[model samples]
Target: MNVSIIKYNAGNVQSVLFALERIGINAVVTDNIDKLQTADKVIFPGVGEASSAMKYLKEKKLDEVIINLKQPVLGICLGMQLMCRFSEEGETNCLGIFDNNVKLFSADLKNTKVPQIGWNTIYDLKTNLYKNIIENEYMYFVHSYFAEISENTIAKTNYGLEYSSSLQKNNFYATQFHPEKSSDAGQKILENFIKI
Candidate 1:
């Protein structure tokens, strides 16, 4: 299907590659502009800090390329954070695909841990990304920073507070949780994305 995974200075690309392999899709991981532009779909996956990741994207001019892709694009975790207007992490500016900001979780939450690791339920599902998935489906998450609920939020999750766990606008789709690590529900999300 000519699916392409955006290659950059970020973690999680290998795991994403393996996830796609599990689905029997042989996808290419590349930073080449042509490969990205011509792919049937593009997966922008990341597990890293926002500012540095944006720096690498800018250096490679991938930020521009990613913003212009007409084909459906999915951003996972940090990749989704970078797709927003700005990030509280290092106060970095981002791609502005989704008109929202990434903010750090409140430190005053006595009972909740920062990063909110492990499984969490995602509800308020919208978009094809969760086609066959039901409400309150648990997805793997590992992050302290989160995208705030906005007009673009397709799904919401709660930890210290409610936040946008998934977002969509036009061709861009994103998940704050790691669908690649979320088991069957995660696999369904990935399969839906591939279909898109």
Candidate 2:
């Protein structure tokens, strides 16, 4: 399969590449529009600020490329955040593949961390992304902002409050948690994505 990881100024591309390699899939990391467009599966993973990343996508015209892809596309973390309609981070507009807004974790929530790092259970799983995964499976997460529960939400997780941990709309899929870093279950999720 021609698996390609979208290359940009974001962090964690190498980790995603390594994870795919571990699964026996040698994914190409590239910003080339043709490679991305023609890949059987595309992984859009990012670990960075929203405004800057959006700026980069606009400059490279990747935003349009990603939106127009017909094959399955997987977005992780900030990539998922960027897929939403808007983000509270930097008050930026996003790709709008999913009609939802990303918001910052409110500080008023007691005994909860800003960037809900580490393992957290994801339930209400729906869609092929969770094929062999069960409800309440722990997934690694590290983010200060989160996408709200909407019609597209496929899986839900709770930290300070309930939110959409995973979402699917047409050919696009996304996860707020870092499946590449989530151990066995994480690998399973990646494997499922590849199969899709």
Q: In terms of lDDT, which candidate is strongest?
A: 2
Q: lDDT per residue, candidate 1, 1-196, as tens digits?
A: 8999999998698899899999999999999999999999999999889999999999999999999999999999999999999999989999999999999988787678887899999999999899989999999999989999999999999887899999999999999999889998999999999998
RMSD of 2: 0.6
lDDT of the candidates, in the order given: 0.94, 0.95
Error of 2 at 28 (Å): 0.4
The digit string of per-residue lDDT tens for model 2 on 1-196 reads 8999999998698889999999999999999999999999999999999999999999999999999999999999999999999999999999999999999999888789787888999999998999989899999999999999999999999987999999999999999999999999999999999998
- Candidate 2 has which clashing residue pairs, if any? none
Could you tell me which 10 consecutive residues in candidate 2 have the lowest summed lDDT?
108-117
Which segments of candidate 2 are over 4 A away from where they belong? none
